[model samples]
Target: MGKTYCHPAMKQLKDQQTRYAPKERRLEQVERAEQLLGEIDRTKRYPYDYLCFRITGFRPDNWSALMIEGDEARRDLRQFVEDLSATVRQPVEQATEPVLTVDEVSKKYNVSTRTVTRWRRQGLVARRFVIDGRAKVGFLESSLQRFVAEHRGQVERGSRFRQLTDAEKDEIIRRARRMSQFRSGEVGLIEIARRIARKMARSTETVRLTLKAYDREHPDRAIFGPSTTPLDDDAKAQIYLRHRMGVSAENLAVEYGRTRSSVYRIINEVRAQRILETKLEFIGNESFDDSKAKSVIMAPLPAPADGKAPRRPKAPKGLPPYLASLYEVPLLDREQEAHLFRQMNYLKSEAVKLREKLDPAKAKTAALDKIDELQEQALAVKNQIIRANLRLVVSIAKRHVGPMNNFFELVSDGNMSLIRAVEKFDYARGNKFSTYASWAIMKNYARTIPEENYRRDRFVTGHEEMFEAAADNRIDEHEYESALKRMQEAIRGMLDRLDDREKMIITSRFGLGGASERTLEQLGRELGITKERVRQIESRGVDKLRRIAGEQKLDLPML
Candidate 1:
């Protein structure tokens, strides 16, 4: 299900027979594609309209500009040229179109006969016929030219093929690391690295590894973001999440300021990644392959109809907000559990089947897109299963809590185990998923939670895991809190430099006296002015305070 990590840049030509065939010289089209591939500068961005004009000679209205990587655009275009020749090139009169045997094409491309076999299965037509001496099994030369137009591995490789200098690696890594600060949280770090790889005419892996090596060397400064990075996985994952929630790529494109195709590209990339990453190990059943398996086993089970998943349940009386919110999703019934498990496994099976048709070397966009759709469907089904079972993690974690085990930490580990069990559970065996998940959660808690820490009694969430591998910052809680105390103590006197209104605004804006910081609007409401005016006064007060701090040598948080 993991798709080829190709940026979407190709648009299928309309009734493209003429362009692909081209006045009895289809071979020339492949040559044209090769030329176009060479002309591509991977670092640059091309708009949809420009790409259409360059590849298909027709510019449409309102095309996206600079939305995808130059290398991916070239890759997709070259693939399309080859696919066109492979799928559409008919086997004409044998005498008219010169024959090229599988061996001959393989030798020419330095590929194995196996590769050509895959090609033939995809679309290239071949025939067994008598040739000069006896008989030869070969496809039309025109077909070979059209279909075998890809030149991927040599150029699109990583460090294995390319030799980048230290300076070159450093530049790419530095730019990439800087981008990772904000972009790695979700925006397009992978896409950006690919662009640099193309721009430098290096393999994409070269850039990827350069960034990775830098990250390994500087673990704290890694480009993938802070450990709490799930808030934004990637633009592709974000787009997929929204799309699963019923947002169309076209509308999302508008919302995200990308071309519709780019949005779809992100979604497909994420979906394919998820499917490929997931291990769909379902227990096989004879009924699974039955002709009526889908209709019967996959029949709509008794559960919420579309749009009927449980809403937020009201907070239970006399409970803390955190614990109460845990009850938002209702538990699933037996049939619903069976339905979700079957749907999840079935969707994965179908995706894996479709994945057989997707070759990373030459992915068919339409097929990949279909795989994405299936992946999304599977994910939606899997999520329903997860939601119905999340509370179960918390329930079991409570029993296993110990002196060393923080409840939240145990719950986090148990939740991960639950997700894994869901993916690994076999619905065909007719066992309840809850039982399997419960076992998984318990198994995870059986491990010892760390018994020692600098601050063993610190009441906090599970973020301490990051500190285990953190660089030698060495500053413990007391030292950090002591530093904060000093800053707070110093800030009290810094307010004296400001006038009455200025002092009030500064104090209120910063929550200096322990009341929650007031917003510009809130300050304006109290002071009888517009929020913008309040902002102006706050700005002046901050400037005066900064100057006063500089004059008095005060070290505060703002300073």
Candidate 2:
């Protein structure tokens, strides 16, 4: 053969062409494999194993190709193998571990084999199987130690794991024997078995078997008969009656034939059904009148006395009657009463002046607007009065401080009474405001006091009648009589002390027969003197009255 030396450039070009073709083919294969693997991963289980097997078959017998591809594939395959090994080993590791047999467990705890078996069945202890048909039962050593420690007092004195003491086991056996003996007689088999199981630390079946054995051993001792004095029809009827009347379960059990538990169950069932019925009735009858109830409980004030005008009593000169009585109840001195009366008169006069500034004819046309404005001002004054009344109620309520006293409730009731008094008061009445409010105050106190005793009950009833009568009469007769007497005495005394001009001034200012309470200016015009001169004469008259009062040691009644 001719010298087969190829050109270096041609050799290099051929090698490059060969290498590039395989690289392109490998990249395409990689892309296809990745796409297929992604599809498999999305759709099916065991994609890694499937893909590995598929790729292996695709390049069968190609060692170089397989080795190159296998390096990348082997990494994922190794991970899959590790995962599979863990899955397979977990349960196997759990199964092959040395577990205590039921007998061994029973012996360790000094309990019967049957008790261990029951514990395994109840999942209180872990269980395994052996080919020999003996169950491998186990509990964690720590758990076993903990259980032993918890019940160390009950364990046998000489036993290693502190299993049941011989004395305790013997006592349990004795109780079981007693229960088995009872079961052999006419007692309930299940209940007797359960009792034996609890006492012996064994299964119910074991107790039942023991009971059967006992019955067989002592056939002559075993007595069988129906329960004597079972619940009769009359007893059942009495139970039903008691249940219907809402008797307690314990009481019902003592009286009736059923157990306390049974009575409770029956009563609860009935109560639940009754509750359902009540709910249904409430839903069906949805005609409840909340407004009607409110109206009945808190009735609105009666329409103003006359159809054309609101009933507003003339402003009184002294404290309201009710307030005066409340204050004087604690025995306020005459000077204190007079001071309070003068302050009240000043407030009333100011209110009257404010009212007079508004034109009456214009007010009639814009009555609603005027009323709203007036009511706002009135509300502010009323709030002050309410605060004062609250204080009075507190004082009055304190007087009732003793056993069975509730000052807050008494105060609350008094407040309501005070509100009613304010509503019904006719300011036009010449009596002191406190006297008019007295009935309301007493009514509030009476409502809270129990009517158990004859004296208190009679007083409460009479007071209620008196309130009703006063409301109807629209005039406080007692107050009117007192005021009339006071007025006569005051006029007589003043007439004796005053000169002619002073007498006329006093009489005209008071308007003895009608329209009482004239201003200084009005009196000045009538007496042909400047208002200043009239004021001086009025001051002199007041001074003379005070001198007389001081000399006679008499306190003038609050005007």
Candidate 3:
């Protein structure tokens, strides 16, 4: 229901009296209202008749009274009056202490601290005061009770409003109209609102709010115009065109006297309209789903007579599909190259240490096997660097791909030189990898052309002599094999001098003791000890073997 007021001063007086009323008087009203509700419930009489009879008691009815028929309706009225009376009495009980802290108010109302702050902003809260020299907000007991009573029905009904009667609203609008007339004059909005507020015996803020609401209701005829004046078709077109020509939103907003967001919104609307127009034109007489456009485009080509997938494009000469695919591998940045370079150095150092225990006679297989594993890991890091800088190789190779050298051959040779550069390139030296790799790649390409020319020439004119010269320089391959076998056997004999555990440690650490060489950590796991402990054992074992070999005067390879 809308608000009803008999008179503003009378209403104000009633509110003040309710706040300062005696506790006994408020309680007596609550009790009397309850008694009337009970009588209506027991007798099944109309609410208005009951109220009139109770007010007149034994007196006869003088005029026809408003009839409120229904138990539920009468009960609701009783409950509302009872709640209001109880609320009024509560403030009297707490008359000695009327202040409340923010926390206290939040707790009583079962709301968050933020909600309490918002209530204060919305003028729903009681007056604020300072406590303990700190600025704080406090809702009086009377104010809180009043708030609760006002909201009780609203809580159940959903729709709610701060009590403002139609007459009061009309008065506010009339004042707002007066302000609007004076708004374009020398009097500013603030001064006009203040003058109207004083005349109406209200706050300037209230007048300001009422004026703003009135303006919104009549936007075109508003005193200050609309909050965001919309763009016309021509203005929208200008925004779209200027934005496309690289004009910034800030400049456009300033030029048009609008916000940046407003200008951007207009531009977006124009673009969307244009897109829709284009799509409509395209769909004339026939239609297709834009979402399925990708699938439509990717409709497969017809299969061949052999019933197989189409063959891939030819890879570059001497480059298999797998190797060529590596070209697509992600390139490493400076940090990545530096990190990989560190790992490579560590692996290299470990490999050097393992090589010392390599038995040339019996441990050749084990030693070479482990060394190959370490080399493979080091090669992985090298390949990453190579993949990243491969573009450099291609650019250099492209310049030399002509008469004497094929593009593929130059690329392959350039790649090999690139790998060498990755291994030696020191990022700490502060030189870019591209600069170093470029010179190495170019030098390789230069040598490649001359070598190709020489090979072609030798094939054409001196094939027989070249074969004779190669044959004359050849050594007995079996003699080299036999000597290596003897050296491995001698090394095995030296290994026999150490104990079984020491021998095993030496073999595994160098790959001679196991199928593959093991890192100290790997050996420790297998031996059920820590890596540091494994290192100590290996060191003691190696020292013992070195001494035995020295005493024997056996020309053992450096261990």
What lDDT score belongs to each candidate, Candidate 1 first?
0.62, 0.44, 0.55
Q: Flag regions of model 2 displaced more than 4 Å.
A: 1-191, 194-201, 205-559
Of 1 and 3, the candidate ranking higher by TM-score: 1
Model 2 earns a TM-score of 0.19
Per-residue lDDT, model 1, residue 140, is 57
How close is every model to the real structure, measured as TM-score?
0.34, 0.19, 0.23
Residue-pair clash count for candidate 3: 5
- State in Å the error of residue 383, model 1: 0.7
> What's the lDDT for candidate 1?
0.62
Give lDDT: candidate 3, residue 27.
Answer: 50
TM-score of 3: 0.23
Worst 10 residues of 2 by lDDT: 279-288
Per-residue accuracy of model 1 over 456-555 as CA lDDT, tens digit each: 5565433222111222357887777776567555666677667899989877765556556666656776887877899899889878877877887765
Q: In candidate 2, what are the lDDT values of residues 432-518, reduced to their tens digit?
A: 446656666876666657542445546543312211112225558787677556745754675578888876766565555444656
Clashing residue pairs in candidate 3 (N, C-alpha, C atoms within 3 angstroms): 360-488, 361-488, 361-489, 366-511, 507-513
